[model samples]
Target: MIGVLIFPDFQILDASGPISVFEIAGRYAKSPASIRLIAAEPGPVRSSSGVEMLARKFGSPSAITTLVIAGGDGVEAAARNPCTLSFVRAVAKRGTRVASVCSGTFILAEAGLLDGRRATTHWVRTRQFLATYPAVKLEPDQIFVRDGSIWSSAGITAGIDLALAMVAEDHGEEIVQKTARQLVLYHRRSGGQSQFSSLLELKAPTGRFGPLLTWAREHLGTRLTVADLADRAGMSARHFTRAFVAETGTTPSKAIERLRIEVARSRVQSSSEAIERVAEATGFRDPERMRRAFIRAFGQPPQSLRRSARAG
Candidate 1:
């Protein structure tokens, strides 16, 4: 059984988002899986919004195969709660795959389980996280960070992405895609945390443009023209343009441009190559075009981004 622990004043989605994905993945697991919601004094735990969710069970680390901790406004309180913090720390010794969603990283950090581990939390808390927990290697701008058995993610809905990754790790990509299909959510988020920090670009594009946008991402390094996208979708440019805008809430060109920019940004952040080299790798042949695209998309040029991304 994969047990998801809920706490008073925790983020609601952090508990539900990953739980839903785990249910679907469990269906595909060799031994399957069962989900249990454990709380300290299990009755109904109040959420950050004051909504009470009944936790089915009331126990700690020994009762489950995996322990998932959700984060929310209450995390600050939980961090200081000796009982709760002790429970979290005790779970680490149980040979369970421990994972944290969003600000839930704070709970683990407080338990002293995160010391010397490379982890990520919501970008908002990065400064405080560094200042408060100097022993941790905080990479705040990532979707998720895995160090041995510990998994930590960025804020809020990143819990879902992190869960999907966990599902992929446990099962495979086919099961991951299946779980995403069950939720009607396109598997994997585009651009990671960079997309969140920048103008929102790659999301689950809807309507008729969905397939086209997916295809565009699959072929980012190539010359992806509007006509090519239209051809793939079997629509004329005029009709495709209207449908693309309606589906994605952005024009086809804008979407592709954003996608390219995101791809470029990934290169800039992940590689030690020169800015010009990264630009060429992401489909911008010339350094100037890449710079302009970066400025238009992120208000900064590729060179500046390269330096900052590397420094971080």
Candidate 2:
């Protein structure tokens, strides 16, 4: 049985999205799966969005094969509750697959399930999560992460991705593909995809440098330099570099590479363009240089990503 643990003011989608995927997968599976909404204090638990879910009191941990904790404004409280933490710890010790959605990771971390484990959470909480759980290896860029039997995901929608991945694991790629099609999702996104799109990352600041970023994105085919960007921003090279880093939390060169990767990746996945052509168009004039950049950014080459995208 899959037990989704919830508390007051939990994110509604975090629980329902996964539940829907599992429910659909159960229908097509050889053996149907059972699911339940569980909570420390059973009753009508209100979600952050004002939707309420009827939850039963968590009873026997042994009956649960999978335990997913949902996250929201009440996570801090859930993490502090002895009943919730102890339940999670006991279930994990019994070898149940433990998982979390969004800030639900905080609860698992508090229960010591995430200690020395590679995990991820919503990108918005990356800084706070890192500061709080320095022992956990956090991959902030991933849409989801699986380490052993533990799984974690980014935000509400990513929970659906996580559940789809679990379905793929339990059933098969074909089952997940069908499930994705049924849900109208274009494809099941690989966990390696960045949490932020290139445009979203560049949309950080609307300050003086914002226009410069826009110009750089448009001129990706050209050799953009610090001096060029500084000239556009009407600042000296040295001053612009420091100010750009301060505003965007990344160096100008790194930002440019990220922009190129984003555009290149989109073209590679969505178009039938050759790798060399895509690389040149994205400002990585050399195909080999683009391959190295793809490796650094995604832990795989452009060809691998394209293959996966097509296969999905």
Evaluate candidate 1 by giving its C-alpha RMSD to the native, one decimal: 16.0
lDDT of each: 0.77, 0.84
After superposing candidate 1, which stretches have Cα over 4 Å from the reference? 29-32, 56-60, 198-312
lDDT of 1 by residue, 141-256 (tens): 56788898889988888888988998888888999998899888767765445445422435554454556677777777788888988898899998886555434334467677
Candidate 1 local distance difference test against the native: 0.77
Off by over 4 Å in 2: 190-257, 262-312
Clashes of 1: 0
> Model 1 clash pairs?
none
| TM-score for each candidate, following the candidate numbering | 0.64, 0.73
What's the C-alpha lDDT at position 302 in model 1? 77
Q: What's model 1's TM-score?
A: 0.64
